[model samples]
Target chain A: LAKTTQPISMDSYEGQEVNITCSHNNIATNDYITWYQQFPSQGPRFIIQGYKTKVTNEVASLFIPADRKSSTLSLPRVSLSDTAVYYCLVGETSSGGSYIPTFGRGTSLIVHP
Target chain B: DTAVSQTPKYLVTQMGNDKSIKCEQNLGHDTMYWYKQDSKKFLKIMFSYNNKELIINETVPNRFSPKSPDKAHLNLHINSLELGDSAVYFCASSPPTSGNTIYFGEGSWLTVV
Candidate 1:
């Protein structure tokens, strides 16, 4: 399992775009980078993921460079409701043999209005 | 419909007691996981089960046991719970073949006094 490092917290005003980055120096060849968002008193929700280059979804975008040692999660047009903790994970497997792996402390994004 | 759901959103119990948190997923996925979030907000993987078989078992205490009776349900039973067990427990599910996206249940806040 690769260990990930990210900011503990960040703050931004509503309607602004926020970019949070994660560092995984020991990422494995089969490791994929994923991001998750969590609100207070709630579980972490899936955001976006990528192996290399970039991947985007309705919620967020994930960017992984060639080295795959780092990734960035971009939340466009933030809102106060977007204030939550964001986690960046690098793993070889998830639930089952699918996309499950290990997750680390995510960045806390405080979207202000 | 809720993709993933957990029971007893909040649990307050005394130490040395036994308690359980139930999780279910309606996404028809084959894998489920249990995670613990400490007060400082660090999320760690405790266990992962796929098709009722244990896959990844972190170095968690033996007091924490995860049982998956079927494909969609994964229940966590903590025996002789301790004060250190007080934290937010999250249940997540994902298709065994999914590339990145994983669904998460709301969470169960367990407070041991």
Candidate 2:
């Protein structure tokens, strides 16, 4: 399992882009970086996953450098509803094809008006 | 219809009480997990079951037992709950593909009095 480090919190205004970076220095060759979003009383929702380079979804975009040591999650045009905690996870598949993604102390993003 | 649903969205109990949280995923996924989010908002994986078999069991207490009767269900039973057990419990399931998207249930808020 790879341990990830991220900012504790971030502040942004509505309509602005928010980017959260995660550092996983000891990432394995087969490990993948994934980002999740959690609201106040809901479960964490999957945002994006990537190995290297960049991957974009309808919700967010994940950018991973070639070194694979760090990745960034970009949320475009943030709104008040985007205020939530973002988790950085590095997952490794076990022999039985099980993926137990471990989450760190997520970066709480507060989107203001 | 939600893909993953858990019963008792809110649970309030006294100390030393035992409670169970049932989770069902209709996403046709074979892997399920139980994660605990503390008050400080740190998500930790407690148990994981794949194809109705226990695969990942973290260093959680024995009082926390995860039962997977089938591929679509995973229930968590906590015995002799304490004040420290007051947190949010999330049930998540993933598809057979490793390191892919994972769906989480609307957490069960457990408040121990």
Candidate 3:
């Protein structure tokens, strides 16, 4: 399992774009990066994921560089409801997977309306 | 309807007691996981079960036992709970492959008094 590091906290105003970057200096060859969002008293929700380049969905966009050493999660037009802690995970999801994912201290994004 | 659901969203119990948290996923996924979020908001993987078989078990205490009766249900039974067991327990499920989205439940807040 690859270790990930991210900002402890971030602040953004409503309608603004927020980007949280995660650094995994020792990412494995088969490792895929995933991002999750969690509101207070709720479970984490999948935001976006990418191996390399850019992957966009209806919720967020993930950008990965050629080296795959880091990834960015971009949330567009943020609202107060988007204020939550976001986690960055790197691992392989499989039926016979061995190593478990280590979720370090996540980035808390405070979106003020 | 919620795809991943856990019973007893909030559990307040005394130390040395035993309790169980039940999780059910309607998403038809083959892999399920239990994660614990500490007071500092660091999420850690406790266990992962796929097709009723244990695939990943982290360095969690033996007091924390995971039982999966079938593909859709996974229950966590904690024996002799201690104050350190107080945290948010989240149940999640994913497909058998990586890069796919993992759905999470609302979470069960366990308060050990």
Best by TM-score, which number? 2
With a 3 Å backbone cut-off (N, CA, C), the pairs that clash in candidate 3 are none
Whose lDDT is higher: candidate 2's or candidate 3's?
Answer: 2
* Model 3 chain B lowest lDDT segment of ten: B94-103
Top candidate on DockQ is 2
After superposition on all C-alphas, the RMSD of every candidate to the true structure, in Å, is: 2.5, 1.8, 2.0
Summarize candidate 1's per-residue lDDT along B35-91 as a digit string, tens digits: 888998998888888899888887789998899989889999999999999999999
| Docking class for candidate 1 | medium
| lDDT of each residue in B1-110, candidate 3, tens digit only | 99999999999999999999999999999999999998889988899998999998877899999999999999999999999999999999999666678899999999
What is each candidate's fraction of native interface contacts (fnat)?
A: 0.57, 0.77, 0.79
DockQ numbers for every candidate? 0.57, 0.71, 0.68
Report interface Cα RMSD per prediction: 2.9, 1.8, 2.4
List candidate 2 segments past 4 Å from native.
A92-98
In model 2, the clashing pairs are: none
What DockQ does candidate 1 have relative to the true complex? 0.57
Q: What's model 2's lDDT at A61?
A: 94
Interface DockQ of candidate 3: 0.68
